[model samples]
Target: MRHYVAGGTEHGGGIGRLIGYILTAQPQSAHDQLVTDTRGARWSKLRSPPLLWAAMAVMVKDRLLAPDRVHHLHIAGRGSTARKVILGGLARGLGCTHVLHLHDFDYASDFLRRPPWQRRAIRALFRGADRVIVLGERDRSTASDLLGVPARSISVLHNAVPDPRQSGNATLDPPAPDAPARIVFLGQLGPRKGVPELLNALSHPAMASLNWTAVVAGDGPVDHYRAEAAQLGLSDRVTLPGWLDRAQTRALSESSDILALPSHAEGMAMAVLEGLAHGLAVVTTRVGAHEEILHDEETCRFVPVGDVEALARALADLVAHPETRAQLAMAGRDQYRNALSIEAYIGKLDAMHRSVSRGALRGASAQRGTV
Candidate 1:
């Protein structure tokens, strides 16, 4: 069996990373992909959205017509939703079964709050999908009630990351007793990711009193946050390195003691999963699918979203107590190995595509050696 996954190819974004994992985990001969969005460097004509969409439309037309190929579309809100609507419609019209994987972070404030025409596109997209994949149960209800998709057709599958432990650099040593705890934040520098709140939390008295250093990584208004960090007197200890490549991120994770996301909303953030996979004690909000898998003070630390004090306390506690931090980090890594690793995710994804024969299952398992 073959599956064609379509989505963005941005390195930092969730959908993009998911596609990367799928392409990387499964053999290319068994599974294929199409890049609907790209961080284009050249090819000026293809950079134009219309021309890119037209080119992809031709590709989709031919691919959907192929025999026994599963079409899985990963869609976010706004422009992503619009593009997939057309693509999914064409596939369905061609008598092909397609899966719609919803990764939109905003529905109430953004997608559902859109105008009538936008609502029409959203409705058309989900209702036509043969199977609908959501990152959590919250979205399962949303698709049923708002988009008129059947609840039975939807599946709640939290996102997963490639196991960092198996990356051959599994160094999760706790911070030295005399050295400051290392805190790393990975996400876009925007309000929804709680970057402003994270900076504020770091500047709080509780955090100020603790012995810690931080690196707020990811792309988005780096100068603005750097300036704010300076104003808060956190510039000395807090470093905003803009965006780190995968190698650099893995290195940061290896050297860091804690991973903090503190997003206001999420459909199961990749950073949190990555934190678990990398064996880092995490301090993040109990929003989205986070509350489902993570237990407060057990698997990882949990703080209330937008509450600077709570966030500060969480960070401070982890910073001060190395034993507690190490325990949580170990627990989180165990959780990753048991369920959230790419191997487990691929098994689930393969099942969603269809119940495969023994030979097909063997083929899927064979690619894990390559990863």
Candidate 2:
């Protein structure tokens, strides 16, 4: 089968990062993905976003026009639904099957609470998809209930990341006696991700005496958040270095002792999975599919969103006790190997693509190309 994976750039954040891993990190198999840029060209910054989306539609239409049985898997969310609904229709008309991978952090509140017409648009996209993939059971249930998609049509696939473990006698390797504990936050520097709350938590008196440093890495309003960090007296210890390259990110993951993401919302955060894959002690909020796989104080440390005090306490505990950090890190890595690894994710995705393509050939014979 001819497989096409379409989405944003790797630097675009969670959804983009997921597509990046699928296209680059996984081992070569029959399911290798041909790629396209739905978000836009590298110089798309100069043009309006809607024009770039139009460009994506043209790309999708071109692939569908090909003679092969195309299995187009689109990974996007939010306003991306608008263009995808059109592309989904085109895929059907062209006798090809498309899998709509719905990945949005705010589907719990923002999407479900949208006005009636907006909700209808989202449901229409779900209806046209030959197969619908959701991040977890919460999203699966939401699609079945609110979107009116059948329960069987929606598959609950947990998000995953490529394992970054290296072999050595590096068990619980903390920094030297004089070096500070490293805390890393990987995500957009925005309100939904709880960046302000993270800064506030890091500035709390509980962490005042601790020898610790933090790197809040990713793109978005860097100057504003840096100013907020300074206002909270975290300018000395906290470093917001915008977005890090793949090498820089791996280096940060390898060295950092803790990964913190106190997000207000999420759909199985890729950072949490990456932290688990890297064996870092994960300190995250209880929102999204986190509670599905991670147990509080076991595999990870769960904190409440917007609660600076709770977040501070979690960070302080991890920093003060190296043994607890080691325990969480080991358990998280074990969880990653057993459930959230890229191998497992790709295996299921390949199966889904095959199933949807076969269904299209057997049923949608009204058009040319697919059979």
Off by over 4 Å in 1: 1-7, 27-55, 58-65, 173-175, 355-371
What does candidate 1's lDDT look like per residue over 173-221, in tens digits? 5555799898999988999999998999899988877889999999889
Query: Which lDDT tens digits does candidate 2 get at residues 150-250?
Result: 87788888988877754342344556867788999998789888898899899999999998999999888999998999888888899999988777888
Model 2 off-target regions past 4 Å?
Answer: 1-7, 26-31, 41-70, 73-77, 112-115, 166-174, 364-371
Report lDDT (Cα) of residue 93, candidate 2.
Answer: 69
Give the clashing pairs for model 2: none
lDDT per model, in order? 0.77, 0.77
TM-score of 2: 0.88
Query: What lDDT does model 2 reach?
Result: 0.77
Q: In model 2, state the lDDT of residue 271.
A: 88
